[model samples]
Target: MKRDQARRAYWSQNLRYLAGLLLVWFAVSFGAGILLVEELDQLRVFGFKLGFWFAQQGAIYAFVVLILVYVVLMNRLDRRYSRDEEDPA
Candidate 1:
């Protein structure tokens, strides 16, 4: 029962992280790139229109960052669960 509970907790945390990251990705890629492109195009970033940059490059950068975030978060989860296995309550 304890093992099952722990497993569920881990997966729940994992899913939560995934959902949050995906939400950010969607906001960046879909929202910024398409939905708000015209408004954002008024702004400039590094001499490039903000909307164009987001549509072409910003979303990709965000995805890479998200991948890094996922790796770090999952590593922390792994370490925490491994420790839990090593020392029981």
Candidate 2:
């Protein structure tokens, strides 16, 4: 019973993390690359327009970063949940 609840809670938290991370990825890939491109274009990076950079490369970088972040978070979550149900409470 307690173990089942702990498992559910762990899964719930995992989904929450996934949702939040994916939202960040969407914001970077779609929002920055498409929605705010014009505003970002006014700036520059490495001789490229910021918006263009984001569209071409920055989004990729953000994705990589977000992936690393997700890995770290999930590892912590895994560690937290690996213990007995008592610790989960």
For each candidate, give its TM-score against the true structure.
0.92, 0.87
lDDT of 1 at 67: 97
For model 2 the local lDDT of residue 65 reads 96
- Residue-pair clashes per prediction, in order, are 0, 0
- Scored by lDDT, the top model is 1
Query: For candidate 2, what is the lDDT?
Result: 0.91
Pull out the clashing pairs in model 2: none
lDDT of 1: 0.92
Model 1 lDDT at residue 82: 74
TM-score of 2: 0.87
